[model samples]
Target: MLYLTIDETNTLIREARTDAFHLEVSDDHSAVADETEPMRRVLAGLPPFEAGAYPDSWREWDELVSELTNRGVTMRRVRVVSEPLTDYLRFLHGLTDRNARLGEDIRWLPRHLVDQADYTTDEWWLIDNAEVAFTIFGTDGDFVGAALTEDPTIVDRCVRVRDALWSKATPHAVYSPSGWSG
Candidate 1:
C-alpha cells in the first residue's frame, strides 16, 4: 500500500492534467466554509473529469456548485443523509443555473437513511474510494477533520448509495417543476 501525505497528494493533483477526486465531509471539516477555491485551482490543472461530494451544512452552497460548473467538471451529488427535512436538497436544486445546468452536469440523489444516525452506509463507502483523503485537523486534533480515500470499499459504498437514492429519487427529466411543462 502506498501512502501520500496531504501536501504531497495536493501537489500531485495540482500538477496533473486530469483526474477524479472524491471528497467526503464530516461536521469537523465541514465548517471550513469554502473548500471550492482550492478545488478549483486543483481542478484547473486537470483534464476533463469528475468529482463527487457528500457535503455537510454550508459546504453545499451554490457558490461551490457554480465553481465546479465553471471548472468544466462533472459533479454528482449523492445525499446519504438522515435528516428530518430536505431543505438542503431543495437549496441545491435552486442553486443550479438552467443555462449552466446542461453544461455543468450536476445531479443529486436523495438517499433513504434507514438505520444510520447522522450518516448512511453509502457515506462510508465514499471514504474508501478516495486516492488521498484530506482531513483538516483542529489545533488539538481530537478526531476533528475530513478525508478522502481510494479504498474499493468506500467507492463501492458510494455507488450503492447513489444507486439506491437514484432509484428512489424523482426523475427530474420526467417530473417538471411548477410553471414548467415537461
Candidate 2:
C-alpha cells in the first residue's frame, strides 16, 4: 500500500484513468467540503459546484473528464447511502447532475440494498478492474490521504463489490434522494 500525496494522487488517477476500460468509485460518506478552495466557498454560501465561482478549477476538471471519456474510459460512481437522505446527501445530490453532464455515470443506492459482506464503509476507487485507491478521511470527514494498490485479488474484490452494489443501485437521473419513500 503506497500512501500518496493529493497532487501526486490526482496526477496518478488522471493518467491511469485514461487507459482503463472502466473506472468505478464508491463513496460511502459525504465528501469533504473544505478540501479545495472552490468547495470552501460552497461551504460558505455558494451553491454546490456553482459554475461561475471556480472557473479555472471547474474547467480543468471538466476537461479531464472529457479527455478520459473521449479515450473510451467508462467512469461510474456509486454512492452508498441510507434512504431519507441526510443533509450531506442532499448537498451531494445537487452535484450529481453536473457530474453526469461531465460524462461520468452516477448512481445512488440505499445501504440496505447492498450485501453487507460485499460492501465497504470507506470510500474507494476501482480503476481498470485492476487497481483500488481507498480514500482515507479524518474524524470530521476531512481528507487525509489515499492508499493505492494494484494487487489482482484486491482489485477483484473491489470489482465484485462494485458489481453487486451497482446492480441494485438507481441511476442518477431516476434517483430522488429528496423524495425517497424508504
Candidate 3:
C-alpha cells in the first residue's frame, strides 16, 4: 500500500478532472495547490469544475475558484468551517453575483468531514477510480505511497480505513467552525 500526504493528494486532484468528479477531503486546514493554481499564475485554462468541497479562505487565490472557470472542471464545495455553513454558503452566493459562472460550474456537496466509519458516494467513487491509493497524513505526517490492486485483501484494508472516516464524517451538512469562516 502507498501513502500520499496532503501534498500528494493535492497533486492527484489537480490531475484527475476530465469531466464531472467527486472528492472526499478530510478535515484539515492546510491549504495546498494543485495544477490549477500554478497554471493560473501563467494563464487561464480549463473551464468549470465538477463536484468537491473545501473550507473558505480569505487568501487572495483559491484553487477551487480557479478551477471553476475551467470548462474542463466542475467544482462542488463543502466548506468545513467553525461558523455556520450557511454563512459560507452566503459568501459563495455573493461571489456568484460578481461572476455568474462561478455558480454555474460549482456545487456545494453536503459539507462534512470524512468520517472514520461509513463511506460516501464520493469516497467510494474516488477509491474505485484510484489505480493507486495514497494515505495522506493529516498532521505532522509524511507521504506513504502504495499502489492499489484488485486483490481482495488489499482492497479490503483500504476500504476499512476509508470507511472508518467515511462513516464518522458529517455530510456537507455539519460545520466545524475553524477551517473556513471567510
- Report, for every candidate in turn, its global Cα lDDT versus the true structure: 0.38, 0.68, 0.38
- TM-scores for the candidates: 0.39, 0.79, 0.33
Please list all clashing residue pairs in model 2, or write none if there are none.
none
Candidate 2 overall lDDT versus native: 0.68
Better of 1 and 2 by lDDT: 2
Q: Sorted by lDDT, highest first, which candidate order results?
A: 2, 1, 3
Better of 2 and 3 by lDDT: 2
Q: 152 in model 1: Cα distance from truth in Å?
A: 2.2
The list of candidate 2 runs beyond 4 A from truth reads: 17-46, 49-51, 55-59, 178-182
Model 2 TM: 0.79
lDDT of 2 by residue, 62-119 (tens): 7777777777778777888776676556556766688788788888887777788878
Best by TM-score: 2
As a TM-score, model 1 comes out at 0.39
Ranking by TM-score: 2, 1, 3
Q: What is the lDDT of candidate 3?
A: 0.38
| Candidate 1 Cα outliers beyond 4 Å, as residue runs | 1-73, 80-89, 98-102, 106-145, 171-182
Which has the higher TM-score value, candidate number 1 or candidate number 3? 1
**Which 10 consecutive residues of model 1 have the lowest summed lDDT?**
121-130
